[model samples]
Target: MENLDIAKFGGTSVGNFDAMTSSYKVVVGNKNSRIVVISACSGVTNLLVELASGKCSDSKINEIIEKLRDIHEQIIIHLENQHELRNYIEGHLKEIKEQTLLANKGTNDQLTDSIVSHGELMSSYLFVALFKHYGTDAQWFDVRSVMRTDSKFSCAKPICEEIKVLAHDKLLPLINDKTIIITQGFIGSNTLGETTTLGRGGSDYTAALLGEALGVATISIWTDVAGVFTTDPRVVKTAKPIPELTYIEAAEMANFGAKVLHPSTMIPAVRQEIPIFVGSSKEPEKGGTWVRPVTKSEPNFRALALRKNQTLIVLSSPVMVGATGFLANVFSVFAKYNHSIDLVSTSEISIAVTIDAGTTTSGKAEISENMLNELRQFCHVKVETGLPLIAIIGNRMSENSGVITKAFDAINKFSVRMICYGASRHNLCFLLKDGDTTEALNELHKQLLED
Candidate 1:
């Protein structure tokens, strides 16, 4: 399958009957797209998350299950084989409700993984049924069969070599022009065959991983947006879709919260040098951005990304003023807690780092109070909330003084808490009060991207 291509549709792309129908048409229209990765329906995963949290009352859980049932029921009703698929969907939903009740008995990541996975599981089944209804031969393949990962429960790490072997043995022979393989993304299994997830937005990463394993020529990411934009259109109405971006630019944008792609989604694609096409499934003919090793255009100011709910933690120790391992020690604490830091800045005797406030991508606390207590052993820890990180993605940013001037000049009126630059030429990031996000984004986009 040298000419094979993996088309991964996001939740919005396959949210309903019409959306799934449109997606299958895109698949059949492109003969090379023999493999399809799908996410949960748009609102199904959120409801599933609420159900899995186990914090809700029994009635709330039942209500959430009904809401989930209604969402899928609306789509399943449109299929010609609606009766059979409806039975299958109801069976899964019943299981979800049961598992959720059992999960509330204790805090179990394993059970949570199983509870939320039904979204993709049932959606893939419906998608296969829908695909067949459209005269296209499609088989629903369990991604866990090939998508092997460590049993990390909520946020599993893929065992790359194992997945490659599994894909070759289980997936390669079945994939052909005669039939398309439909599979769920973000959900995988471990050595013991327990269900696991790759955190939120892992569907995009799944597509890239499969693309690399199959050595596909191209990976297409279909979403609600036409392409990667200068900024979120919701935040700035004038935000425009970017036509092309180098892999570095795309990776930076994703890492800094562009939301169009998962941060880790770019890794396998970059390693394999596979080109990725991101477009709107609703309007595939209008075209979208192409992310490659190099793009024809390399602007100094390409786009802006705003990451909300950031907590700024400043560790102050006079020893850090002239110490060597101070930064390493601080990072080791974060490593122990398994929390990732987005941006950091250091002064003469203090270092401040920004971590996502509230819960992480896996639906767990970003940083625990105990972690903070441990840091207090050697330094004074000051924590500030309600700060959002804004990233300016571009090329030669460090080398271009004028570009940096224009960027800061735009948002200089805002009280910038912490700034991180000179480390990555592709991005310049800073922390701002949550309240300043809209106005700051507007000012930055207007000056940097629009001007």
Candidate 2:
């Protein structure tokens, strides 16, 4: 069987028609049967969101509409077979604009869905049209028709079994024909037939999910960056790209705070043991990061990722020093909020949990009020904000005695509040003051990479 390569282009790659045409050429250069997943043109999603929420003025909406029209027009002008494709895009854009305007006045879920969905709809149409203009055997596939989801608006969960059935029955036929299919990522339809978006940065997830369903050999996420870095270069000057990583390490780094790939995007790919690549759309020739199962390469520290604005909630119960399930009940409240626990440290008298301090500007005292009230029933809960959690991720760190020592020596000046290593020892998460995050990351990266 020929290896199937599924490539997903992010918003930056499809930000404009020139970029779209460039990416198309890159795909053609691969000279292989592949499916391309595309995100909406840049800024369109944000504009749509603002318009749908009635947060922007009519002038702003009109400006966005004009921009969208101009981008499509430019692409059409450059196409060899321009007339038909141009008309199709114009018609679609007009319809999208009208619907967007109509949906602007209301805050209904349907309106939000209609407005936010145009990004992918427009991009999918443009991608297919561009590919056809280049004389490739390309066809546009509407993701909503095949990617089944629940009725949740902002963060809909995929119905995998339903999706698998639909993929086999509806999508596989085109694959067999060797047709290059272009589909929008991040948008799907619920059972009730309402348009729903997968949460933020969901395009990568869409590509992985589709790759898994198709049982593809490889999934390539083509983004602006060359590959995943040892640490965010913006924070650590010496941070370098990691050539490869195990799926477990990549997932842990992503979950801890690596922005290259979404944490949940790896689930399907890992389940199938599919090789995933993170490469540059511009520099396709350059080898990028490869994520797969364990290889002969011994486990080494692959990357450091830091999630900021962390709040540490400490629950101390003098009365429950020897009690069982005391921590379970406290964790239940966090599960209810869907807040991810980044790090945890516990003792006989107290339990400390670290969570992301989402957008709330409230000081630690105010932020802990609800949790403290709940804890007041059995213990004293104290909250500390303005902190950050730095995660050191590696598959072999458990056997490397010097790893933790080196990390501490690197950032010795920073005030670390707590440390929690996962049961599997794949990750070491430490809490530091928010202001010290950058310094700690720089020091750690230098220590790991320089010598």
Candidate 3:
């Protein structure tokens, strides 16, 4: 198969019949052999989360069920001759409903993954049947069969080598034989053959992994938006679409709160030098952001990423100005608690770090109690919440003259809590009061970007 590209449609992209129609056009218009990945219809995953979390008990479960039925029956009524598929979806929903009636059990992550997986599973099945109805030669695949992961039910990391072999053995032949091969994103199976889900915004990760396994050079992420922007459009109205970015730039933007793509989504792609294209399912003519290994032109500063709900943890210890294992000790607690932190500014006497307190997922707490207690053993710890971390992202930022003064000038009006610069090649980060995040972004966009 020549020119095989992976195209993944997001939840809203496959959310309804109209959305599916647009996506079908995109899938069918392509000249190359393509693999199609779809997420659950919009809102389905959240409902599943409620059910799986036991947030909706027996008394309240019926409400979520009615909503699910309304959403699916709307589509099912139109997917002619797929009674088998409809029954399959209905069965899964019924199981979810029944499971909710019982006390929610097992690893919370595992239960949530299993229940929420219905989103992708149902979406892919309905989509494949639609493609067939419209005379497209599409074959549906259960991604769990091929995409292998650990037993870590939520946030399951793909075992690349194992997944590569499994995908090659199972998916390659299907792609080779058909013009279109359809599968779900954000869901995989463990070695135990139990259902598992990747973290939030994981559909992108699934698409890229499959593309890498098949040796495709690029993967297209089809979503509701047209492209990645210079900054979040909601924050800065003048934020325009960036035509292209290197993997580092995109990864930095993702890490700094570019919601278009997941931060870890690029790891596998970067390893194989597989590029990514982010585009809209509805409006394909506008083009989109292209992320690859190299770029024709480089900008001094490309974009700004703002992450809110941050907690700044400051640790001051007088063990000595020079301490042997302080760095290791502080980081060890992070690992022990499975805490994912963002930025760090260190001094001889203290360490300042920022993490997303909003990292709480469907049914999990962000801060770990044991980790916090351990950290207080040796250091005076002060935690401040309600701060937003704004990252100014670029390439070769160290060499960009005046970029620092200019950024600082833009946010000078805001109460700046911390600034971490010259530490990372891709971004210069600033901590700001939550109230000042928007004001800072607006000023920076005006001062630093071209309208």
Which candidate should be chosen as best, given lDDT against the real structure? 1
Question: On a 0 to 100 scale, what is the lDDT of residue 414 in model 1?
Answer: 92
The global C-alpha lDDT for each of the candidates, from Candidate 1 onward, is: 0.87, 0.77, 0.82
Could you tell me which 10 consecutive residues in candidate 1 have the lowest summed lDDT?
A: 357-366
Ranking by TM-score: 1, 3, 2
lDDT, candidate 3, 195-230, per-residue tens? 878776788889988888889967899988889999
Candidate 2 local lDDT, residue 390: 86
lDDT tens per residue, model 1, 28-62: 88989999999999988888887787787988987
TM-score for each of the candidates: 0.97, 0.85, 0.94
Pairs in clash, predicted candidate 3:
none
Per-residue error (Å), model 1, residue 432: 0.6
Model 3 lDDT at residue 323: 62
Candidate 3: residue 65 lDDT (0-100): 82
Candidate 2 structure quality by residue, lDDT tens digits, 109-174: 556766677778877887887787778889889888889988856667898888888877888778
lDDT of 3: 0.82
Residue pairs with backbone overlap in model 1: none
10 residues in a row with least lDDT, candidate 3? 357-366
TM-score of 3: 0.94
